[model samples]
Target: MTRGWPARLSSGEVTLRPLARSDRAAWREVRRRNADWLRPWDATVPPGSDARPSSFGGLVRRLHRLARQGTTFPFAIEVSGQFVGQLTVNNIVRGSAQFASMGYWIDQQHAGRGVVPRAVAMAIDHCFFTAGLHRVEICIRPENTNSLRVVEKLGLHEVGLAPRFLHIDGAWRDHRIYAVTVEECPGGMLARVAAPPETG
Candidate 1:
């Protein structure tokens, strides 16, 4: 494990920082308000699987422990010091396969103002330059147009589809895999995000 994580990253008003015990109120408030908006994309436990942490503290503790083990980076997404969402870099693998997958959600009120793309770029930059990982992938459900727009904005390559890849909203859902390697973003992904759009 490295010393700096769970790290704090920022670009303008968007920031990614470690989740903490004190974030219970703000986190719960945002999630509660956005439940209906987020339900379609949320992951659920299968019938036979063990129950996950019920309390906010337990969830934060578990993620912190995993961060110590070097397998995950759970972050609370904040815009100008106001908590708005979450972005997690999970399932990190080292050795021959230095890659990980990311998942995120944003408040409905802040959905399309470019907050997510900036956070994603920052996280990917950290994965490549700071964390020493080779590749980062984001798997999105086909119907998730907001998420699809994010990958499109960043120009990530769509590798393939994974049928029934993950259990989401209580059923097995297929996902489209989008990935970017360190080699592909040699100048860092944030730069791409900050660049002015190309006009046709």
Candidate 2:
């Protein structure tokens, strides 16, 4: 069954919605402005030969195709009506291995402001509750302390490391894998946020 795209989710400070064609300009601007900061962490794509359409259009087309294939779900992170970043749950697998890998990036200006964690919590909730997935995995480069913190804050445990797990920024990079099962997250992410903190 084709799971319709999720409605916009909000956590008071950040909101997420399905990316639209109208967002191309703003998204491209955010990307260009954060190019240096994002390049080190983004997936590398081959250079295009023809210039008929801009790279942003090509990217939108690619995402639309993936959406139709049910292998990917992508969202634009918006803060106060501006596109600030992107989030994705890709490589969705069903049957015995009902899971997907999650990834995200934020505009440098929005970093360290709890934007990612809120957006991630929203995404994980959708994956487990709305999408009916058994588990979600987040793989991060060991050097990405910020990403590690985001997962840790969400209560996902480190499963293991995969050598040369992904081709990022042109080369194969090792990644530390972390995951949380639906059974382990019965109450969903919102529950974690509402639960009382533990005292030592």
Best by lDDT: 1
Superposing every Cα of model 1 onto the true structure, what RMSD results? 0.9
- How close is each model in CA RMSD to the real structure? 0.9, 2.8
Off by over 4 Å in 2: 4-6, 46-54, 194-197
The digit string of per-residue lDDT tens for model 2 on 26-50 reads 9889988999998878876435534
Worst 10 residues of 2 by lDDT: 45-54
Candidate 2: residue 4 lDDT (0-100): 36
- Candidate 2 shows a clash count of 0
Clashing pairs in 2: none
- Measured against the true structure, the TM-scores of the candidates, in listed sequence, are 0.98, 0.90
TM-score of 2: 0.90
